[model samples]
Target: MIIPVIMAGGSGTRLWPLSRTAFPKQFIALTSNLTMLQETAARLDGLSGDDGISPMVICNEEHRFLVAEQMRQQKLTPSILLEPAGRNTAPAIGLAAIKAVEDAKLASASNELTEFPVLLVLAADHVIEDVEAFQQCVKSLLPEVQAGKFGTLGIVPTEPATGYGYIKATTSSGRLGRVSEFVEKPDAETAARYVAEGYLWNSGMFLIRADRYLEELKNFRLDIYDACVKSMASTQLDLDFVRIDKEAFEACPDESVDYAVMEPLAAKGEVVVAPLDAGWSDVGSWSALWEIADKDAQGNVMAGQDEKNFILQGSENCYVYGSAGNDGSGRLIATLGVENLVIVDTPDALLVANKDKVQDIKKIVSQIKASG
Candidate 1:
């Protein structure tokens, strides 16, 4: 069985105005008609394993309704796991692994079936343009996962980007290779060098056996494993949502899956990487949104209700994201001779910044919170 676990607990402060604390990037329809969460679930249309395929979503407690509603729109009834607090990916994934094991055992007992589930861990806010290519990448990693080795998709770097972490593969061989090391986000020069060396952008997508992940997490980060087990022991299922104990999860350490598990495993040469060349973007910033967005002849992306609503006068390489008549009334947004700018207009906030500095937009969000 291939169990897809969608991690959807990020605030996405970098994409401030439109992506707020209440409604983050994952819930927004950034690139397509479907929201990013919907797209994530929809992209798994044709995938199946030996047993079967079902998605298990881990999201913020506050956004449980939003996640359920979005998945419901796509006619998908995924098992929603609610995190009472933001304990990061390590604990989040641990919870999923624990649940998967428990569920598999129950199925085996009830139906008299032997089942082993392989988890396909995906981020909810990624923009993978080529669904076929993405599916192929997952197919390529299945063998490694089935072979009892931890596997993750490593994106073939199209550019020297400093925003994402890099994965150093042991050998630049075929579609799959042993992961050498995982590096932190680097400076410009370091990123360029990594690109030259054929390092991949760590896509944060994992394919591993449910039991194996739990065993490994128990081995490497026992504290996280214990907390997740305790949290799951007290899990309460409310309709379509599985709510973990808040106080127990709050006491769990805040760490990423990479820091707690993948890194340590990679260091021991137990991790494998599948190189994915699909057009994948984390959609972490406004500039990232511009990169994936469809643009005009002058390298400008003007998003609104109609062409007439947004008049770009000699603007080159600019991104304007807003909706005319968004809330039943219209607002015409015009740009005059502005080059390389990002203008985002939302109901409560408006943001304007240089395209190059969009990565630092999180600073503005921090200031806003400070003022309040």
Candidate 2:
């Protein structure tokens, strides 16, 4: 059985104004009619086996209701786990791994059969246009993961994108390749070189046996493993949410899965990479959304409640988003003689930036926070 673990704790500060602290992009419907969280859960509908259980979502206490409501919309009764503080991906995943092992042990005891659950780790905010291909890629990696190999999905780079880190595979031929090295995000020239040399984008998705992951966590990051075990030692169920010990989780260190686990495993050749060619994007910025969205003949993408909410005159390669008002009406946004621009208009804030400069939106967000 495979237990899907959805990591849904992200601030999404880059896509700010539209994506705020109260409601992040994971809970928004940027690419489809369903919310991103809903879409993430929906895509797993046909992939699970007969004994597959519902997904387990890891989110913060603030977004507990949002996670529950969105999962309810999909008619999925997921085990919602709430973190008291923001500890990075390593600790977050550790908590889920511990919980999966516990659940598997309980099932084993009741059924009088040994059951080991493999975890399909996924991010809550990603856009994959080819769902079938993604599912196929995941299915292909299951056998290796069930055999105790840590599997990571690597996106086939369509372009020289410097925004994401890269993974160097030992061989790019078969269904699985030994992960040789994990490199940080590079400059444009380095990114181009990486693409030319066939490096895959680190998709932050994984498939591993629950017990295997816990063993690894104990091997390398013993501190994190201990803290997570302590946190889960006193897990309390509140309705649909699972609450951990706040003080115990707060003592955990801040680290990502790559730095704490995958990197070390890759060095030992225990990590395998599965190349995924599905059209996938993290939707980190407005430009990324524009690249995947439907565009007019003049290369303008407009998103709003009504079709007449925006007008573009001689604007090429621009993205304009007009948020709706509380009364179900949208404010008009018109752009004239502009090229390569992103204009986002919301009720409380507005963002106007060049397409090439969208990566620097975090700097602007920091400035706003400092002023307040």
Candidate 3:
């Protein structure tokens, strides 16, 4: 059995006004008609058999309804796990692993099931253009994971991007490679060097047996493992959501799966990398969304409720987002003789920033909070 765990917790402050703390990027339709969370769940359509269980989503209490509503839109009944507070990826995944183990055990006791569940950990905000290739890459990693090896999807680098971390593969045969090392985000020169040496971007996607992940977590980070086990012990199901123990989960240390498990396992030759060449983007900033969106002949990407919301004259390489209110009424924005700028108009805020400075929009959000 394959259990999909979608990690949907993020502040998404980088995308600022459109993506707020209460409403983050994952719940927004930044890339397509469906929300990013829906897209992530929809991508697993045929990969799991008809008898397969729905995906498990781990998110904070604030966005529980958002997550539920998005999944409900796709007609998917996901096992929504609600965290009391943000504890990063390690504990988030630990909660999912614990729940999966409990459910599997219950199913085994009632039926003649013999196979254990394998977790396909995916982030909710990634944009993978080629769903077929993405699913195939995930399926390819199953054999190695079933053979007692931790597997992660490493993206074949298309450029020397300094924003993402890199994974060095020691040996390669076809799509599978032995994970040699995991490196942090590097400077331009170092990123170029990594790309030249054939390093892959760490996509943060993983495939591993549920029990194996719990075992490894216990071996490496006992504090996290113990806290998760305790929290799951008192899980209460509240209207299709599994609520963990608040105090217990808040006591868990905050850390990512990379530092807690993957890196250490890579050194022990227990981790494998499946190179994925699918067109993938994290959409970390406004510029990234512009790069992937369809543009007009004038090199402008405009998004709004209607085509008349924005008018461009002699504008090139600009991204303009005009958001409307509940009644579908918004101000008409006109741009003239502008290039390489991002203009976002919301009900409460309006942002007109140079394209190169979009990465620093978080600072603006910080200043706004400071002023209040």
The TM-score leader among the candidates is 2
Q: What would the per-residue lDDT of candidate 1 be over residues 1-372, giving only the tens digit for each residue? A: 788999999898998888888999899888888898988988898877343456999999999899988887877788999999999999999999888888888878574326678889999999887888888878888887887899888999999999999999976555688997988789999999999999999999999998898889999899999999999998898997999999899999999998888888989988888888778899998898898888999999977455667889899999997755446445788999999999988767888999999999888989999999
**Worst lDDT 10-window in candidate 3:** 107-116
Error of 1 at 182 (Å): 0.7
**lDDT of each residue in 1-372, candidate 3, tens digit only:** 789999999888989889998899999988778888988998898897677458999999888999988888888899999998999999999999988887877788664426778999999999998888888888888988988899999998888987788899975445689997988678999999999999999998999898899999999999999999999999898999999999999999999898898888888889999888889998889999999999999889988656688889999999999986788887799999999999999888888999988888889999988999
Give the alpha-carbon lDDT of every model: 0.87, 0.90, 0.89
Indicate the TM-score of model 3.
0.96
Give the C-alpha lDDT of model 2. 0.90
Model 2 steric clash total: 0
Give candidate 2 regions above 4 Å deviation.
Answer: 49-52, 110-113
Indicate whether candidate 1 or candidate 2 has the larger lDDT: 2
What's every prediction's RMSD, in angstroms?
Answer: 1.8, 1.5, 1.7
